[model samples]
Target: MAQKKIGSVHDLQTILQISQALTAERDLDRLLWLIISACSRLVDADRSSLFIVDQSRDELWTKVAEQTTTIRLPMGSGIAGTVAKEGQTLNIVDAYQDQRFNPIVDHKSGYRTKSVLCMPLINSSGEVVGVIETINKKNGKAFTARDEQLLGALCSHAAIALDNARLLRQDLAHQSLLHELELAHSIQQGLLPQSAPSISGWTFAIYQSPCEQTGGDYHDFIPHAHCQAVDVVVGDVSGHGVSAALLMSTARAFLRALDQDSTRPGQLLEQINHLLVQDMADDRFMTMVVCRLDESGHVRYASAGHEPPIVFRTENGYCDENVETDLLLGMLDGVGYAEYVLPPLNRGDLLVLCTDGVFEAVSPHTGEVWGMERLRELVRKQASVGASALCQKIMESISDYTDHSPQKDDITLLIAEKT
Candidate 1:
């Protein structure tokens, strides 16, 4: 039966249906079939073949809708490839007559070649995902500009579908990865000391953020049975990855052992650093703040190149550095580390501890870190605020400053207040 000619808007009711069906497809392979089928039907071509570019193979593979047989063509080796390489449409009135028309596909399929109207399949990034080739227009007539117009509209829909499929896959993969990360993050949070040690007349909070799905930041407050001392720790490893997260776990295990000892904070950190420096990978290092808080909250602390904790005084809107820190742990062997002291903090004063993610969160526009100065400002502003409120306020500030840019690094926060 001779097909009705697509000569008027009324005749285009089928084309409109084809467009809607193409857009409605979400499965990538099914969408490809719908596209090539619509192109062949609209143009009344004898065959419609899709050749998707395989970058790794440097070939165009026919992934769907084979009219005769499987078709694969070399890049820059045939009419289809040339159309793709040039990013243009080519109507070969006589495919055999063209020097670039490779006869290998026809030879393989045992089909006589006559004519081909081929167009490059482009995606949003403007890269060629594939090519569509329609062969032998109906009634032995040549394909026209109107046929090109119809095919062009179909190709536009096809491009959008292809891009949607690609992005959908990426999002699914990222989501799955985040779920795994969340699990590890939850387990690590479980390891953190819960509710701080209930020492009379003392208060503490831990703030932590992981730059990725998980992070290298660590913090804890351990109570003593015989002494007024309570162990505290804050540490950050050198980088971000599952490997870094593992290293942090090991560091935590080591700290737990040291916390069991009735020893000086300085000696404990040195022993841990000595053990870590001997075997940590070339790129690995950790910064830490270790302190012991007594019943009266007289905090004796030490550092290993970790950032200083900021203490906000209620006497006025002033934030002071509690102690100076040394270099990060695991960077070098036999590095010495030690503890220091801090005067007893009064009720209403707050202590803030963090990893580099705190100071390094950038203003999306300016690309500058939130920095130490601004951090102190937030602490002072929230001096009268509860520990949870202070933590929330700082986090909100970081998010606003970054302008919702995808978090570049893990974020961690810990707050200690005497009430």
Candidate 2:
């Protein structure tokens, strides 16, 4: 009865250790290793080993701790294998004397086996992935049921924890990247238009967001034509990160300098391209749609291998207007930045521009693109709405299609709606 009471007490202690292991975030690995190592001490053994089932090989592979490396033993080959295959515990007083004992690993690692205690590690599914085997029993003693009970409980929780750690590790890695990305995101936000310009009868808006909180997309609005025309820039850098963001800042500065000339779109681009080609990396380039929207609503724009802005004529039932395509900036020095002239704009005209992310959303199940045509229809049907609402609706559509998958690239939308 005293022994029985001691066993119950030991089991409770094991349960508490499990609870503590589960609750802790930092000490889980130590807890698992400590429990398995303590199995031999608790049972008065020389050393211990743990193994999980490998269904593919139909064998019990050794998972060696650096402090206690185990050798791979085939199923039914050694004392550990027999115990695991039988789903039972074995306490052998003389391992070397037993013909079933495999001497190969001991021969390799230079450890002798005198006594053995091996048990199967079975989960709730009744499938065995591993075995826990101990040796020598320290001072010629043998293992006890108490040791079996303690180690059994430890193994159950350890297996679960190990599986969880593998999965949680991925999440941890992503979160670490996210934290770094937040720093980049802060820098990106600072580069945007801090606030709206003070202009009469003009509505200005800009939006940029990465699929993963940081990417190469950007947008800005600035003074142009001696403060007579407004310079609007929407662009995507060639890649993501602080590097791309730095390039974006450079682009903004160059655009501002070019805006001083009251220049044509193509001319402004040619000049910026000449400067960027010298500064940008071999792979670094920018796709930009720059436009000058004047107080009278006459628009002149240029493209540098970027998606054309959709000029929605509200009076004509949301007709989407597009200009000609051109080469991307930074592709070569002395490139032309010719400007594209727009027709005289009327009241309630909307210009929609964006990066590649919004149009690249694919259905998770069917893998179909959400496409730019659908995006235009959404804007056309909803162009009368303000800038914020239009962007929100388009984002919602993309999310619905992709199930909120990571944004493949940075997304930007700039609205130069003439009221």
The alpha-carbon deviation from the true structure for residue 190 of candidate 1, after best TM-score superposition, in angstroms, is: 4.9
- Candidate 2 regions exceeding 4 Å error are 1-26, 49-133, 140-150, 157-187, 199-201, 207-216, 224-229, 236-286, 294-298, 312-323, 327-338, 343-349, 356-411
Clashes of 1: 13
Writing each residue's lDDT as its tens digit, candidate 2 over 1-419 gives 99989878976785676546543644445644654665665566777777756666767765444345656766777787787688877767787888878787788878887877777766656766567777877777666666677667766765565555545776888999888878878877887777767655568676667665656777777776465877677888887767788898888788777767745667778888888998998888999888778888888789999888887887777665585878898888867766788786778787778887778768888988889899889888998886667877888888888888776677777766777
Q: What TM-score against the true fold does each predicted structure earn? A: 0.62, 0.60
Best lDDT among the predictions, by candidate number: 1
In the range 302-368, model 1's lDDT, one tens digit per residue, is: 7899887777778777887665777678887666666677777787877778888888998878878
Error of 1 at 266 (Å): 4.8
RMSD for all candidates, in order, please. Answer: 6.5, 6.9
Cα-based lDDT at residue 270, candidate 2: 82
Error of 2 at 316 (Å): 7.2
